[model samples]
Target chain A: MNLVGSFFGSSIGRKIIMALTGVILIGFVVGHLVGNLQIFQHPDHINGYAQFLHQLGPLLWVARIGLIAAALLHIWAATVLTLENKRARGGDYGFKHTIQATFASRAMRWTGVIVLAFLVYHLAHFTLGVVQTETFKETAPLNHYVMQNDYRVAGFTVVKAGTDVANVHSMVILGFQHKVVALFYIVAVGLLSLHLLHGFNSLFQSLGLRNAKWSWLLHKAALALCVVYFLGNLAIPGAVLAGKLRPQTAKVAATAQR
Target chain B: MTLRVWRQAGPKALGQFKDYAAKDLNSNMSFLEMLDVVNDELTLKGEVPIAFAHDCREGICGTCSLTINGKPHGPGKGIATCQTYMRSFHDGDIIVVEPFRAAAFPLIKDLVVDRTSFDKIMQAGGFITARAGSAPEANAAPVPKGVSDLAMDAAQCIGCGACVAACKNASAMLFVSAKVGHLGLLPQGQAERDRRVLAMVHTMDEEGFGNCTNQYECSAACPKTISHDFIARMNRDYLGATLRSAFQPEAASSDGGGA
Candidate 1:
């Protein structure tokens, strides 16, 4: 086998792959959550943010491709490792008892599958606009370069036309307003939280980043990160379902059209 | 005391728990001695006695391995099956005894298992190619106190297979880590440190041992109380070895040049 192939074929090598890919995916989720949180600010804020990403053009596609690769690698490594573990176990114990493994750790595979399913549904609901509620309507593409008077690149004014700028702020609000969709999102986020709870610390361990001195602190940090992600992501649907967030006002939509 | 012991005729035979009453058992007797009493009675009655693995009954030998009441080496910590005493249990208490379970350690009989896999892993790379000679002076190499202490801590693993039985995934990571860390920490073993770790881990995987989940049950159930820290240390070393082997395969192949 080639050097790269043999390295990846080792158990530790596979774990390192999972860890690296996992960190990248976690970074994307945190960034996505922060971007989505702009829905509470105003319709212009999120729509403008969306337009900014659209204006990035090729750079956005690169990032999208990178994220897809990372997700695929993470899932692939996880599946191989899980299968190897099952084979290692050979068969169930005549009598079994667990001493230190937590519920989240034991259920990591199932929770991971749920998170993957949720990722697909999330992409369809907001990114593709294919799974929107009946009241949902697509917003016209924003010409962000022309719309933002202060937009600049490297101290120079750049004028460019932006296309396919869906008003994601309104879409998010409308989607969460549906009780079933909101509940599904909430449950999915819960499972994601469980996955992150075990996965975050596991990533550190798999990458050989943990030691006796730092293990406790790293575990706490992982738990805290999971909680932050859970609460932050959950707040959006919670607010929308409680009627605290409403669809874009007609005045706001009209101003964007101009 | 009521002894609930696992009974199996052979490797492929069906196993089941059979209860036996231990009448007139002395509280001062060791756990195995009590079993001996029960076996003596079974022999007098012309029934096949319960088969178990034991040697050097003082606990240094790793052979007397059993999972007692769902915990390897009985309920207490840092002691082997033979070291357990009857005084640890109440007079009327019911005890459950079974062999250590793992895919790598297949059942041979009632309580004996084929632990030759561990031996095979050891054979893969668990040694140094040092020349045999008269004993050298203790301070010949001048190892630091802390390094020797850490090496001693890892060297306590007796290959009892408790770690495998304790792990939910049946991972032998703790055992392999112990072996790797013990030798890798010593200056003399440095010649083959990288290669030894790689070969042993490879053999461990080949033996069908599961991957480490970092649950710490292995350390908890260890008869020698081997720490889980060794597993992390082994992981770090494994990563370093793999990367070095990938990028500098020729360099790792030298094996300290002289040796």
Candidate 2:
């Protein structure tokens, strides 16, 4: 009903929105992964990251709201465009699958829905202290911080010995140590990868940039990036569940107990 | 050899593909050349030679438009019926030729239809028109090779109407997109870009051409092999136009007319 309907009312308009929003979302995912990968740097590195995000105060809230709005607009536009396309098709008369569609085109709507659902679960598991240990937050009572990758600094650095906080770090470790939560995060990353692989290449085509010279390479690059991001995120959760790596504190406990 | 062709004397006239046998046919002739032989024989026999339109026996003009044996321009890519050799067909084969038929393209006489709508759409936005009486030097503008290539791709549309005939929905999105792309790419067209895209797309809708379903069949049937990329460009242009129009709504009630 907002900018989405008018934006997607015509074929050309829908393509523009799809391309623009797809690019935005892809950029967000890349940045988000880069931030999340800080967990591998050191356990406390993520907690430091969380505290940094918390320092932005109102600006961080504003950015979060802006991101939510963008994601909502993108999903709504895609749904409306798909619905209109279906209606234009006259209620899907006849099974013409093999005739007029590729595997990626056919799976677009389904993959989109799956990715949306996975996003909700992902935010709850990692970012929100709901459904997981509260230690993932910057202001947790203990210095057990788990970084969602993006953080703002409120003047707390590793150099300041007295500023040690355990809440945020412990939250991340406790959350990932739970095999179920880690598995869900791993699957969510997989779905995100699939969504990106199709979305990135499609954006260029929709924006009318499908030139013969660069099209093939652009498509290959987008797919490769998606795969890399998916595997990178999955690796963290996979390591935890497979017992390849335990929490840093847990490894210390094992040594002391043995 | 026999030629079976569809004939409808008028728009309201019921039509059928009637067979006519050819006597003393030369195998070493063009398909149209063979048709000429049949027509000459029919005239000698005091019958109306089958009504059809063709010009420039070569394939370039695109005026030699036809749907032969359910194939546009008779089964060869980048070639027309006038250039089609009789060697392509075997003895005793009955070839069926018919006029290009669509609601937008009304048949005139026999093979010719009023393709003036195409001319009209072109006139709407297909040209790069700068200010009048101020002719700038040809080299004043510097267009990159990629833009020129894209412009050329859209320019390749010969107005053959094969896209309309091939589409089940009878969409002219491909044809209209070509016209849009041809003009939109040039620097000279930037002045009227918004108006041009809006005018062309509006006219296309009014002409009763169906919306593109992204099926890519139109590209397949096109003799020029016009890509669906132009359609994508059209979509981009249309979106830009929508945003522009929203900002600056056109003045209504500007049409002054007498009672």
Top-scoring candidate (TM-score)? 1
Among all candidates shown, the one with the greatest lDDT? 1
The whole-model C-alpha lDDT of candidate 2 against the native structure comes to 0.67
Residues A57-175, candidate 1: write the lDDT tens digits.
99999999999999999899888877887777665655577767788888888999998999999888777667753333353432221233333446654433343345567667767
* Per-residue lDDT of candidate 1, residues B66-145 (tens digit): 88888888877898888888888998888888888888999999988888999999999888888899878888888888
Considering just the first chain, candidate 1 attains a TM-score of 0.86
Interface RMSD for every prediction, one decimal? 1.8, 6.1
Name the runs in model 1 displaced over 4 angstroms.
Answer: A133-164, A250-258, B249-259
Candidate lDDT (C-alpha), each: 0.81, 0.67
Q: Which residue pairs come into collision in candidate 1?
A: none
Worst 10 residues of 2 chain B by lDDT: B205-214
TM-score of model 2 (CA atoms): 0.62
Clashes in candidate 2: how many?
Answer: 23
| TM-score attained by model 1 | 0.90
Task: Compose the digit string of candidate 2's lDDT tens values, residues B1-259.
Answer: 6777776677667667678896677767877788889889889999777777777877667677666776656666656778777778888887777766566677765555566767777777777665588667878899999889988888888787777655544567788888888878888778888778877766665565555545565777777888877877777777767767677754665565434
